[model samples]
Each structure stands twice: as C-alpha cells, then as structure tokens.
Target: MKLIAVTNDRMSIDELIQTLLAIEPYIDAVILREKSKTDTEILKLIQKLKEVNFNVKKMIVHGKPTIANTEQIDKVQLPGGLPLPDLMRQYPALLFGKSVHSLEEAIVAEADGAESVLYGHLFKTNSKPGLQPRGTDDLRRIVSSLTIPVYAIGGIRPSHIERLREVGIAGVAIMSTIFESEHPKNIAKEYYDAIHT
Candidate 1:
C-alpha cells in the first residue's frame, strides 16, 4: 500500500520540513493539506521543499490548481464536491485527486474524472474525535465501485494495514499519528513494514 503523510496546522515551517525530510523515504507522497495556508504560502513552502532537495513531485498541493500548475508540481488534491471534471479537462497535465466520504461520492468522483480518491476515518484518531468510524465494510464498498484508486485515511494505525489491504484499498493516508510521533522516520518505516509485510 502507498503511504501518504497529510500535513496539519500545528507544525511550524521548520518542523514540517524536518518531518517531511525524515519521512520522505518511507512515504509515497505528502499531501500538503494545510487548508488555511494561502496559495502564496503554499507556493513558498513548495519552493522551500525543492530548495532542500525534496521530491516536490510527490507532494500534492491541496485545493490550488493554479499554484500547483505554476509550480509544475503535477498533482492537486481537491476538496470534496469541488466539481473537478472541468479542472481535469482544463489541466490534463495535472493529476487530480479528491476526498470523498461515501460510495456515491466516490462514483461521482470517478465519473467526473478524478485520478484517485482519499476516503475514511476507519478507526478513529486524534484528527477526528467522537464520530463513529465508517469501518472496513464501507471502505470495501467504495473500493468496489471505483476504477480509480481509493486511499483510506482518518485515524489509521499501523496495525490496521492487513485488513485495509484485504479490503482492496489502494493505500493509506495519515495525519496526526505520524507528525506527532517522536521519530517520524521510524513511524513511517513501521507503516512501510506493515504495508510490505
């Protein structure tokens, strides 16, 4: 399974870069999901990552197709219900991804031409509190409906990999559990091991 690291608002610029650098080797990509960051701010962060020799291509800018195109980053993840079919046609060069909550949305995304979808809250994590998890059955249903990949997200842990893979998810995306860990590299490695095992 492909492991993606989703960024949160808590980390400072330095800590974020350090975390990205440490975990880069283990994760397939990093979704820069700092939703509040302005387009200019996201662009500057992209520049910084490139300056540090990080793989900018593996970084997916959240909700900013213009910035992503100008930066030549090649991937932009749109928030749910943004109606990306037009954007996908407009920027054929860009890989468009989405965040979907249900099978119906996943099918809409697929029909609308999203290259992939990120789905979940599979087991409850600090990122999402109190709400009940959508669980593996829901995940499997979504996976079954889409030809494009569906990545499980929200509250995922290392121990859940086997079941996720069994359900036919393309990969997993994580947030707080990775960034808050004492050793981001080791945390990423643990997930990688679970994926490859």
Candidate 2:
C-alpha cells in the first residue's frame, strides 16, 4: 500500500521542508494542505521546497489547481462539492484527487472523473475530536464500491495498516502521526515498513 504524508498546517515552511526532506524516501507523496496560507505563500513554499531539492513531483497541492499548474506539479487534491468535471476539463494536464467523507460522495467523485479519492477519519483522531470515526466496515463498503483508488485517511497508525490492507484500500493518508512526531523520519519509516512488510 502507498504511504502518503499530508501536511498538518501547524508547521512553519522550514520545518515542513526539513520534515519532507527527511521523510521523502519513505513517503509516496505529500499533500500540501495548508488551508489558511495564501496562494502567494503556497507558491513561495513550493519555491523553497525546490530550492532544497525536494521532489516537486511528489507534492500535491491541496485545493489549488492554478498553483499546481504554475509549478508544473501535476497533482492536486480537491475538496468535495466542487465542480470536479469542469475542473478536470479546464486543467487537462493535471491529475485530480478528491477528498471525500462518505460513500455517496466517493461515488460522485468517481463519476465526476476524479483520478483518486481520499476517504476517512477511519479511526479516532485528534484531527476530528469528538467525531466518531467512520470505521472499517464503512471503509470496506466504499473500497468495494469504487473502481478508482481509495486512500484511507485520518487518525491512522502503524498498528492499523494491516487492517487497512484487508479493506483493500490503495493506501493511507497520514498527517499527525508523521508531521507531529518528534522524530519525523523514524515515524515515517515505521509507517512505510508497516505498509510494505
């Protein structure tokens, strides 16, 4: 299964770049999900990452098609409810992945031509405090229903990887488990090993 690292929006650009550099070897991709940062700031972040020789190709800009196009990064992870079909047509060069919270949403995303889907809060996580996790049964239903790749996200841990694989998910999208750790590289490697082994 693929091990994707998602930015938590809590780190400074420098910290993020350093973490990315350290974890790059283990992660399949990094989603730049800085919702509050301006487009200019996001552009600068990309530039900084490039300056450090981080692989821009592995970076997916969350909710920013124009920036992804500007940087020649071909991947963008879009939130649900947008006109995905129109966006796909507008940016034919870019590959779009939709973030979906439900099976209905996942079905719509697939129909709308999303290349992939990130679905979750599969386990209890601080990211969604007090919100019940969607759990494995729901995840399995979505996985079986969709023909496209489904990446499980939210509150995932190394211990959970085996169970996730059983659900037939294409991969896992992780945030706090890597980014919030004191030893980010080790944490990333742990997840990588779990998924691979």
Candidate 3:
C-alpha cells in the first residue's frame, strides 16, 4: 500500500526522465502509462529509466506484461475498462491492480482476480469532471465490501492522507498533485509525510 505516480508520454524524453528521477525516492511505484508511445518510444523510455539506476523493480505499465516481465518490474496495472483474462490467475507473478469507480465495479475487479482496486473521486477532480464525488463514507462502504487492499484516488493530497488513513485505506494514488508541480520531489515528500503522520 503506497503511492503510485504515473508519467504521461506527452512529455519529451528529457522532461519525462527528469520528473521520474525527481520523484523516485518518495514513490513506492512508477506507472509508465503513456498511451501513444510507439514500441520504440516505450523501449527508449524504459532504457533511459534503467540508465539512471532508478529502481525498475518498482515500476508498472499498462497491459504490457511482456515489458514488465522482461524488465522484472514490481507490478502490472490494467486499465479499468478492459476485461481481465483467465490466464492472469496462472502467473502468481507480480501484483495486479485495477481502477474501479463503483462498488459493483470493484467487486467485478476482485472477482476477475485483481489484487487491489483504485477507488476514486472521493472529492470531485478536474480529471474526473462531472462525476459525482463518493466522499469518505461511501469510500468506507466500498472498502468494507472487499477483502483485498483498496487505494483512494482523486483530489488526494498531503492534507487529505490522514482522513484516508483514519478510514483504513491501504494506500493513496496521486497523479497531477506531483506531476504538475515545479518541484515534484518536494510534493512527493509532502505526500509521504502526510501519509506517515
């Protein structure tokens, strides 16, 4: 249960590398979720990350278990919309986490063999515009229905970590709070401090 931040392939390679390096120390995992990167681009990004001696073991990418398997990364996260195949159960391999916005969706993910689910929008977020916020109470209700770990997402920051901790959430997931910062390292530290507190 820890912070998992992702990088957008939208950034140039240099910017991408810098951001990853800056926040590496505070991150429990880095999810390389670039949607449009060609295979060559993806390979280049992976190689650059390795060159910096970043802990590749703590990395996860969407649907590319081949890359994760070959690179020996920590986990593989699948997009919420995709169906999890029966073959996933055979791996006994890396952690498998998925995103879900509803209790039913959460249940589906668990039934489909996800190790954990990323529950979201406890507060309205720009990334999830127009979606109703599920507040802490609703979040608690969702977590209580599942046996595996649940990580809270959407509008979470250093300030909100304690409330989530109080409710017994396994961890927190953040995206823009760290990525949009000029100093992502400091922001990550702030989130780590809040969670630890």
| Candidate maximizing TM-score | 2
| Rank by TM-score (best first) | 2, 1, 3
Model 1 residue 43 lDDT score: 77
Q: What are the runs in model 2 whose C-alpha is more than 4 Å off?
A: none
Off by over 4 Å in 1: none
Model 3 residue 106 lDDT score: 88
What TM-score, over all chains together, does every model reach?
0.96, 0.98, 0.90
- The C-alpha local distance difference test score for the whole of candidate 1 amounts to 0.88
lDDT of 3 by residue, 1-197 (tens): 48878674568777888998988888888778887987677778888899998788777777676677666775778777765765375455767888788889888989888988888877767677787888888679778999989888888878788778878889888887787778889999998777666
lDDT sort, best first? 2, 1, 3
RMSD of each: 1.1, 0.8, 1.9
Q: Count clashing residue pairs per candidate.
A: 0, 0, 0
